[model samples]
Target: MAASRKVAVASVCLVLSLILLQFYVTSLHKELRAKILRAQITTFMSGLISLACWYLYRRLLAENHTVLACPSRLLWTLWKSVVICFLLCAQVTYATNLFFITTDPQWIAMVCYICLGTLIQLVCCLLVCDLIEIGLRVLRRGRQYQQNQISLKAQQTRTVVAILIALMLSARGLTVGLSPPPLKKVTIPMTKLPRSFDGLTVIQLSDIHLGPTVGRSRLQDVVDRAMATKPDVIVIAGDLVDSVVKKLGEAAEPLKQLQAPYGVYFITGNHEYYTGDVDAWFDKLRSLNVQVLHNEKAILQNHKQPEDTICLAGVDDNTADSFGYDGHGEHLDKALGSCDPDQPIILLAHKPSCAKRALQSKYNVNLVLSGHTHGGQLFPMIIAAYLVNPYYVGLYRVSDHAHVYVSPGTFYWGIPMRVFTSMEITHITLQATW
Candidate 1:
């Protein structure tokens, strides 16, 4: 908790520095000078609203004593609340007037795209502007032309160029964020993979995050794309929805269409426990005929050659135990205990950090699939994601016998933007090296 708070404080300081940088850059223009005060007020109000939302969310979590009483769960809730509140405040600040006009989700989303997109553009442009200024300083070192002084025309030109760069990048980011996740084909050669199970294709969809911005239409499109692949098995590693069943269940109805030769399986992501109704989501997915794996295993066999079989095991999110939910905790032992040691094992965990533990376990787990990092989801932020996750995205060969694949995500969450990262539907094929 203390560490999280310190990180939060550092983030606040960085944001303040960025705001100050924004003011300094804008002051160079006479027209923008007048708008600085207004911008400052907007930022202040946004901060206040974010604080209020954070407090309320924390209080709400506290009220849910059964789920969030634990220190770890509270800490997670608080951190999530901070992020959600910050984004909400950004949207509200950016679309202040639009909220009065209509409560439509589309309009709100449009406002979010425009506002957040513009903010991202502005931040990038400012950074570029600073870099240009620094380079000019370096070039002019020891020269007689007043140091730290740049002509208005030069500044304006630099700003214009930065704006152009920002526009291009933001446009690409929004396009990628809004588009259907592309299918990413990956083949993992397993030394112990059974001959019959060779060439087994599994489609992985993780972090779909169906909520206000991403809904039924988007989900349907993803489902259609996955079906087109004709995979042998389909797996939703975790984070399928961001909201409760009552809110996004209809949007998730497309899951019923996901069928494969083996089956469609799901495991809990941290977001599931955050929804405060993990069991409800389990029931909902089960109703859709999606096998919900809770620290359990399912034996996949080639009906034609019943002896050619493998174990497919899935565990709950790493943080599930912290949420104090009964029958919900990541238990690799329980999931893999009954599996035949000789047969290859494929484990599905939501977070990549679990890959290390799975590999170190007694079982000869051949492959592990996960997706929680979202490939960092945004620029600069991806750096943080990389630092935290052992495996950020894509395939990693942990050992000669084991491999791990981390998908960026099926879709994004919050802000409706994906800067340097992309959404993906991972299609993995298992090949027998033996």
Candidate 2:
């Protein structure tokens, strides 16, 4: 009750701030009536969203005749979803108001904007929820799968894991969000690269996670920092957003600004699969010249064009049902069936576990870039990432030939904190090996 009151008070203050800003802007630009009305309309929209959520809860889960064990699940889900929407609004509205962007008042435009924005955001929420549910389900299945092999009591392990989860959540409020430190840098030796590709600097970065918590301004700063290095080629491994497509418009704009002649490439992290809109996101990336490698492929020509040829192979996120008919996601073996043995190739797979398969395959890809760990996203959690990801965060010689680099994710998922992890923009150089 106290927290709700506090939020209500804060919301009222936000409305007042909007009004004050409107009055000030009107003084500077006299034809500000439309802007003023737009602010008022947005306020009304906020109230409607709040009320609609409340009514929805009352009708669905909070009603008198509920039978579910946790009827509040529906309400709680909406609550979390709304919080994310409002946070995004805070980011977008503040930026718009600061720049004095013209606010449109056309009823149709307003309706369409609201519908699209809400749908995009809701889709992202649904995406996150789906991944969580699926992960939990998988964990359950994995536990049952090994039940016969286990000699210890299952409850004992469950209790231990539960405590660890609680500790991670608690520590999240403690160590994360610290002025994150600089990214770690190390060089990899490429002894067998083609002579034309020697001393090639390839900047690698992954897991930006832009959304309710991490915003566009922060990403823009990172992008600027990355551009300052002038890398030969920029490769975004995966898990770029902490959240969904709703945040895509705001978050992606910053990434679009990162420029390199060789080009920027991306692959989907598990989060992308959760949203069920990876194809739409791929289309969006193509618009910005960021080549997205689905389990299939794309080609990046060397600067010499004639003398240079680099192939890119991207694998799909490793969900139980990701491949569909593409022979790329789940059926990764098929995706690499047509690799060229003589040419140098770079692969983007979301998880490091794919490294084992990638290493054994007869593909041309020499280096595989991946990020899903976020270095565990929490302490003790990285253990899970390590358990799941064949490589821990950073570069590793998985074998005598294949190389794997796992990025500590780009952003946080739900905790809104970063603990010991710092967001990274990598700068790597490729060399001409004999």
Question: Which candidate comes out best when scored by TM-score?
Answer: 1
- Global lDDT of each model? 0.76, 0.57
Q: Model 1: how far is 100 from its true place, Å?
A: 14
Give a tens-digit lDDT track for model 1, residues 1-434. Answer: 99999999999999999877765744453324324434555577567545544543443333333323336866766755654654564547434332321211355655554455545555656566768877876776553564534434455566557656866877788888878788888989997787888899999999987764677888888899999999999999998876567777777888999999999999988877656566788899999999998999999999789988889999899765654456668899999999999888999999998877888888899889999999888776798999999998999998898999999999886556788898898989899999
Task: Give per-residue CA lDDT, model 2, range 139-177, as digits (tens).
Answer: 664556475334223333443344345345444533444
Off by over 4 Å in 1: 1-105, 131-145, 148-154
